[model samples]
Target: MKRWCALTKKKTVLLYLDRGGGAVGVCGGLFTATQKGQKAPETAEGAEARFTRWLQSEQLFSIILSSMSDLQEALAHRGSSPPSVISAARSGLSRLLDHLLDQSAGSFSGGASEWLKLGLSGRALDLKALVSALQQHFLLFSQRLHSAEVERRSLRLEVTNLRRGLQQGVPSDHFLSVCEELHQALSREQEAQTLIQDQSKQVRTLSHSTQELSQARKEVARKERSLRILGKHLSGVQKEKQQLEERLQRAEEGQRDLSRRHECVVNCLKSAETSCKQLCHACISRIGWLEQEVSAHRSHVTALRSELQDACLRDNQAFVPVEEFPEPFPPADPETPKPVPLS
Candidate 1:
């Protein structure tokens, strides 16, 4: 088993040697030219690229050295190194170093005996392989470093642009404080907007109330006008009633005067009736006296008529006796006319 392990370790070292030999052949010409100061023909851009790559390679070498030391410390403290330590060490150097370290740790036995045997037999070979491996690693690190430098430059430009844009508007030192103040201002603005909305609602309510009050006042004014008209009508009616009362009073006074005149006319009619009765009695007595005088005159007229009739009859007898004695008497005067015979 120990023999098999030893063989495997040798094989791993041989493989690393082969790889290192190939890298030396490829980069040997360039390394020789730089040392002799016989710089290779290159453009300005190519020379600048080479210089940046060299600087990055130096930085990488330092990082690798730091990781190796950290790994050694971890091994001493814990008596065994964790996988992270091994990974850190492997990532820092080339794959060749990783293969060698992995084989030695995994396949070999521990202790002084194994160490002495490995050191005595392979020390010179290991030294030669290590030197070659370092050269190859340097070349690989340079290539990787060139690519890393280009990416870093691009990232640096982007970061510079971002920083400039931020500085144009606000200072980086107080950026957080400015943002906080802006947030507070926005909150206050929102509160003020809400208060304004509430005040608008109150104003609208007041306007509605004012309109209602105006309508009420109009209604009151209309009612006042109607009351004024009614009062005028009532006053006219009162005036008419007053005139009627005055006329009625005058009519009553006329009726009292007519009653007094009617009573005086009735008393005059009674006196006239009494005077007519007295006149009627006096006329009746005068008519009775006139009838008595008419009877006395008629008796006187009848006595006178008897006297005239006796005288006439006596005269007729005397004349008739004288006719019998007419031839015996003496004659008187011739001229005396004969007496008229009585009829």
Candidate 2:
């Protein structure tokens, strides 16, 4: 017995040493391994602890071994250990198997003290050997029972066929139904076998496929890296588009504002133009009235001048022409086309 290499479902090789100075292992979930030709450091405390653990584990493993050779091989690794201890371990294994399997515990002599001797005819009756013998017997019985059932079914088919050939033939519906069921079962089995063959074919090609898997992984990783880079580029492009869209929206708002201002300015100009037209009409009317007043005053001055000229003639004074007098303002025709004053 040696320190456990692993307490797992798979075999694990370790650089530990055992008494046999070689290797021994168990199958299906628990096994041990050690470094070849290597030995543990001799220390009292370490040896006691290792022995205790091994003692506990070995007794359990001995009960688990289905093969006599595996059991013998395991026992051989004990290598010059105390017989009393080995006997105690074997007895424990026997008792445990008896209890677990519900076998008669007293069938084998526990006090024989010769568990190390291998083979069925040996002085020590190994309990594992008895279990193996029982399993063989059970398998043989099952095979015989299966052959008997096949023969029985074959005879039933023949009887059914022969009855159907007779004049009074009336084939049993139950038998025919069973035969149909058997045919269906056979077809299903063939399909299952086909599926198994396909799986086996895949298994045969597994090494080549496994080799390709590494390259496939590399390709996948490279594709992932490229995808990541592309994603980053896409994100950047989207951000730029968003920024451009925002700027466009802002420009649209500014244009709307400008249009509103333009509309307001146009409305104001229209109102100002209408007011200017009204003021110009008023000023033209006032200028026309002033022109009429000036015309009347001119007429009065003309009459006075004529009268003065006659008086001057009577008194021997020189007459002056009305044209010689300077006009008080420019003529109305010129003033009529002049610009009006703004309010």
Global lDDT of each candidate: 0.57, 0.58
lDDT of candidate 2 over 4-108, digit per residue (tens): 423322343233222122221222122112334434334545655865785578554665553233345546776635663565465445445334332222322
* Per-residue lDDT over 104-148 for candidate 1, one digit per residue giving the tens place of the 0 to 100 score: 434332422333433534332355655665666666557556645
List the lowest-lDDT window of 10 residues for candidate 2: 23-32
- Give candidate 2 regions above 4 Å deviation: 1-200, 204-219, 314-343
* Candidate 1 runs further than 4 Å off: 1-227, 292-343
Alpha-carbon lDDT of model 1: 0.57
Error of 1 at 187 (Å): 28
Q: How close is every model to the real structure, measured as TM-score? A: 0.25, 0.32
Inter-residue clash pairs, candidate 2: none
TM-score quality measure for candidate 2: 0.32
